[model samples]
Target: MQFYVGWSHSDALFSDYYSDCPTLVSAVSDNQGTLKRFKNKPNKLIIDCGSVFYVKQQKRPTLKHVFEIQRSLIDECPNTSSIRLVHFDEPMFNKTSLSDQYYAMERTLYNAYEYLKVVSEEKLPVNVSTMGVIQGFDRASVHYSANELKKMGYRFFGIGSLLAKNQKQQIEFIKYAIEAVGAENLHVFGVTGITQMAEMVRMRVASFDSTRPTMAAAYYQVFYSNPFRTYVISASRAKPQSDRLGEPLYCECPVCKENPQDMFIPSPRPYMRLRSIHNYYHLVKTIEKMKVGTEREEVV
Candidate 1:
C-alpha cells in the first residue's frame, strides 16, 4: 500500500524522496496553496473532507456540508487523482447510539451517491478513482457498510474510525472487511503505526495515511525501523545506543545527514520532524516490500 502524508504537518517535512507518493489534503487541516503546491510535484493528490470526528470532536456534517465540498473540489481542485466523498463516523470513544451510527452510515451512502451523480452530471474532470468512507462498530455493521457502499458504486472504501482500536480489533475489522469488500478495494485511514501495520503485511491494502509517526517528536523520541522491527532511540541514556557509544549516527535521511549531532540533543519539535521522516521512510519501504512479496524486513 502507498502511504499518504496527512495534512496537519508542515510541508517542508515532505521531501523530494516522497514526491511520488500521494499526499492527503484535508479541507479542515490545509490552508490555501497547499494542494496547488503538491499538484506541481510528481505526487498524486488525495482529497478528503478532513472530518475526523473524534480528532476534531464534531458531529457528522449535513448533506449540505458534504455537497459543498464535493462542488468545491470539483470546481477548484478538479485535478485531484482521488476524491473521498464526505462520510459520517461515530467515534468509538464517544459511545454514540447504535441507531445514530446506522443513521450516519445511511446518510454516508446517500452523500456518496449524490456526490458521484453530481460529479458525473457536471462533467467534472474528477473522473478519477473515488473512495467511499466506511464506518461501523461490529463485523455485521462493517459488512453491511461495505455492501451498501458497493451498491452506491464505490469500489474503493476507506475504513475509518479505527485509530482507537487495538491491533487485534483493527486486524479483525480489516480481515473481515477485506473478505467482504475484497482487499484490492480497501484503503485504511490513519493507520495506527508501523508495528501494527507490519503485522498486517500478510494482507494487502491499496493505500493508507498516517500522522502518528509525527507525534513521536512531541514525546521526545526518535524512531528507526526496518520492515520487521522498529527501534526507539530515547536519547535519555536509559539504554546504551550509538549516541552514548561515542559513535556517529549513520544515516542518509536529510535530518541525520545534515544535522547528525541534533539526534544526540533532545528537542521535541526537531526530533519529531526527524523521527517522523525516519518512520515514514520505513513505512513506504515496508509497503513496497509487501507489494513484491520479498521480505528482507517488515514495514506496514
Candidate 2:
C-alpha cells in the first residue's frame, strides 16, 4: 500500500526534520502556499477537505464551503490522484449514540453526493479523481456507508474517524469496509499505526497517511522500528543501540551516518528530522518484508 503523509503545511517547514517522503495529503483550504511548489512535481498529491464539516455554528466550514475549497484546489492542482469531499465524522472513538452516528454518516454521504454533482460540471478539470468518505460507529452502519458510496460511483473511499480504535478494532472495521468496498479502493484516513501496518499491507490497503513519526519527533522522542518491534524512546535516555546490542542503532539510515558515535542528536530540530527519516525508512522497509513473508517469525 502507498503511504500518503498528511501534511498540514509546507514540506519546507519540516525540511530540517524531513522524512524525505513525497506523496502528500493536504487539506484544500490550508495548503495553498505549498500547493504551487509542486507544480508538475513527481510526487503524488492527495487532497481532501481539511477539517470535519460538523463544527458548531460559526466555527464550522459548511459542507458547501468544503466543496468550494475542494473545487478550487482541483482547479489549481489537477494532477492530484484523488480528492475527498467533506465528511461529517462523529467525535473521535465514535463516542456519540448510534442514532447520532448514523445521522452524521448519512449527512456525510449526501454531502459527498451533492459535491460530486457540482464538480461534474464542464468547467472543472477531469484528470483528478474523487474519493468518497465512509463513516459510522457500528457494523451495519459502517457497511451501509461503504456500500452506499460504491453505489454512488466512488471508486476510492476514505475510512474516517478511526484514530481512537485499537489495532484489533480497526482491523474489524477495515474488514467490513473491504467486504463492502473492494480493498484496492479503500484508503484508511489519518493512520499508519505500527501495530497494524503489516496487517494492513496484507489486507491490500490502497493507501494510508500518518503524522506520528513527525509528531513524536517534535515532542523530543525517537520513533524506532526494530526488526522485531517498534519503540518510541525518549531523547533524554537516548544512547547508542550498540550500548547494549553491540551494534549501531541504525547504521543504514542517514541519521545514523551523521551521528555515528553517539547515535543520539542533541539539537531538537535535527534530531527530530533525522528520527523521522529513520522511522519512515524502517516502516517502508518493514512492510516490504512482511509482504513476502520474509523472515516471517522476526516480528513476533
Candidate 3:
C-alpha cells in the first residue's frame, strides 16, 4: 500500500528526507522529462489527468498527448517500479438528471481505455495500472460505475467524489466495489486527514492519497485551531510549507517540525508555509502509525 502524496499540477516540493514518503506524481501529457527529475526519489508517481468531464471540456492535453507522456516515461525512466493512470474528477452522471452529461463522461472514459491499450502496446518495462473512476452522487451510482468498469478490463479501481460525502455511503460504495473487484485490487482516492484514516483502512484500500500532512500546520496557524480539524485550501501549497515547517526541530524531513501556533509572518509567508509543513508531517506520521498498528494486529 502507498500514499500518493506531494503532488502539484506544476512543480516538485516533497524534497526533505523527513517528507520523503512514498508519493505519486501526476502523469499528464507524457511528462517523461518531469518524471525523470524525481526518478530516483523515494516515491511511486502516477500520471493523473482530470476526469472524463475534464477531458471532454479539453481542460488538459488531448488523449493522444497523455499517451505521449507514457511513451516518454518509458523511454526515460526504465527502472521505475510502476506507473498509474488516473481519471481525476467526479462522475458528472450523478450531478444532473440529464442522461447526456452522464453518457458523455462515460464515452470519454471509454475513449481513455482505447488510448490506454494503445500506450500499453508500446510495452514499457514498468508496470502500468489503470484507475477506474466510480460515478454517481449516491451509493447506487457508485455501485453501477464500479461494476461497469470491472467489466471493462480494469484491474485497479479508484473511488473519488464519494469520499467527502456521506461516510457510510462512501464506505458502502467502497465495500461494494471491493466485493465486486476484489479487495486486493482497489485504491481509494482523497482519503486524507485524521477523520477518515481508520475507516478507509478498514475498507481495505490498497492505497490512499491526501495533502493533509503538507498542509496541517498551515491550516492550524491560519485558522489558529487544532491539527485534527482545520482544512488546507490547496495541496500544492502544502508540499512546500511542509518542507519549511518541518525544518529546525531536527525534523529529519527537509522541512523540520515547529510550534503549530507560531505567530504569522508575511515574508516567505512563514505562517502559511508552517501550516503546510505541519500538515505534511501529521499526514506522514499518521500513516506510519496506521502501518504500525496494522502490523501489530497481524502479530497478535
Candidate 1 vs candidate 2: the lDDT winner is 2
The Cα local distance difference test for each model comes to 0.60, 0.62, 0.53
Q: Per-residue lDDT for 147-223 in model 2, tens only?
A: 88778887888887787787788988888888888889888887756667667778988877787666654544444
Ranking by lDDT: 2, 1, 3
Question: After superposition on all CA atoms, what RMSD does each candidate show versus the true structure?
Answer: 4.2, 4.4, 6.5
Clashes of each: 5, 1, 24
Error of 3 at 115 (Å): 3.1
lDDT of 1 by residue, 1-300 (tens): 667776553633463545465666564423434444433442455666655532465465554565455456444453534555544443443447788777766665666777667655555464456678776778888888888888878778888777667878888888877877887788777775555565455587677777655654444445454433434454654453333323334566666767656654555465556666655665566666665767635343
TM-score, candidate number 3? 0.70
Residue 167 C-alpha lDDT in model 3: 62
- Model 3, 188-267: lDDT tens digits are 76664454555666555687777554444434332212122233333234433322331122233333334433423322
Q: Which parts of model 1 have CA positions greater than 4 angstroms off?
A: 9-17, 37-42, 53-93, 227-248, 263-271, 289-300
Best by lDDT: 2
Model 2: how far is 102 from its true place, Å? 1.4
Query: What TM-score against the true fold does each predicted structure earn?
Result: 0.76, 0.78, 0.70
